[model samples]
Target: MADAASLPRPRRPVEMSGTNQSKRRTSRSWFSRPWASRPRTGGSWHAVAWIAVAACCLPLAGCKTWKKMTTSEKTLAEERTYGATADQRIDELAANAKKAKASSHADQVEFTQGLVKAMLDEHDPRVRCVILETAAEFETAAATAICKGALEDPDERVRMAGCTAWRKRGGAEAVELLAVRYRADPEIDVRLRALRELGDLGDREAVPVLATALEDSDPAVQYRAVGALKKVSGRDLGDDVNKWREWAADPDGSTAEWTIAEGFRQLF
Candidate 1:
């Protein structure tokens, strides 16, 4: 190390006054003297920014009151915003059905049925499903009529929706109608849906019709029918097993067929 005398001079001491005097010196601003002093807070840019942010947030905090809107007020706001949209109208109907409120002057049950019937005509499959599910809650004459008409809709989703609706509204006539679709619907998916709905209806009267589907050209339709028949009759239909096995081996058979056959095996 260098000798003390040759070492760098000690930094000149910053002789601060007493606390009050030192604070007074630091408090002197840009206009304090003939030669202006630098600002103590670097012009306070950060503080100014924080004050602006706080001012903005004070107004924004008032917006939190929107979350406390009553259900009726929320409904009114939604109606005002989305009134012209068909989707909004249908959603309103669904909400009303769940809340068991009438949406129109028509019979509450019939109004719900008509709304669901219209939804079955919608281009979106999910909308049709919602309509059917909500319609099932009505379970009145008009609700049944709408579901019956939906069975003939060109879209498989609409038809499946009808089937699900019918499942919830089970009666002798509903079972018969579903059985008819199980027998005569040209689309395999619709046929399968009808069979499933029939099984859920639990009417032994559907068993014969479903059993016929076990002979359908489409293995998926056949398997659905077998499963439905098993559920309806509560006894395994033994004669159909070999046919199911043959169907499972078919090169063109669907995975639905094999899976459904396995389900039947487990259930038995």
Candidate 2:
């Protein structure tokens, strides 16, 4: 222990005179002043950000929403609160569908039912498109039913998706579905998409659909039909609709277009 007198004294805090304080405040900017000397605030700004984040009012339990939506639905579901948007719900559905392959039969059935419900209840054209696309992953009859219904959906966007879904579920049936869409859709855009998918099919059945599209009233439709014919028929008619129509009128009469791959395939 040291002697008391040998111990160093604690210094008192400095006090400034009114004139000195005024001079110090005037000399320095608000931000330049020592942090301790600045005025203290409770940070109302922090609360403002929090309030903004929580401002979105959530709906009642029975109200329509994409995520965990009510089972009893007649009209399209409405937009949801934060973290529960229609897009987010669709993404979640797609993700869960990926895992559903490992799930039990009951779970798969439940998931499919929920997804189909979402498809029927969703009013957003983009959301409906996603639902139609999601349905393509499952080979269930219910899923197929919704996808078929999309072709006749009031929204052309959904109808366009219906064309794509059928293309993914390819076969003679897919060709037939696309052909129907091309022949009957009121919207020209949907008809164009149908022709595009039909060409992608590369099936013999699509040739007739493409040929019929060549005679459509819309020149754009006819032009698109010519492009599809080039792929489905594997022959370039020089983009002339008339020449393609002539060939389509008698497809078996024309020679096969030669390609390196086709030659090799023929050899094998």
Per residue, candidate 1 scores C-alpha lDDT tens digits across 189-208 of 77788889888788867756
lDDT of 2 by residue, 1-268 (tens): 9999999999997999999997787557446767555534424555677777666444433333444645432223333223356766777777888887678877767777887788877877888888788878787777888888889999888899899889889999999889888888788899899999888888878888788888888899999998888888876656778888888888887443434476467779
Every model's TM-score: 0.52, 0.63
10 residues in a row with least lDDT, candidate 2: 73-82
lDDT of 2 at 104: 82
Question: What residue runs in model 2 are displaced by over 4 Å at the alpha carbon?
Answer: 1-83, 104-106, 255-268
- TM-score quality measure for candidate 1: 0.52
For candidate 1, the per-residue lDDT at 217 reads 84
Model 2: lDDT of residue 131: 77
Give the clashing residue pairs of candidate 2, or none: none
**Strongest candidate by lDDT:** 2
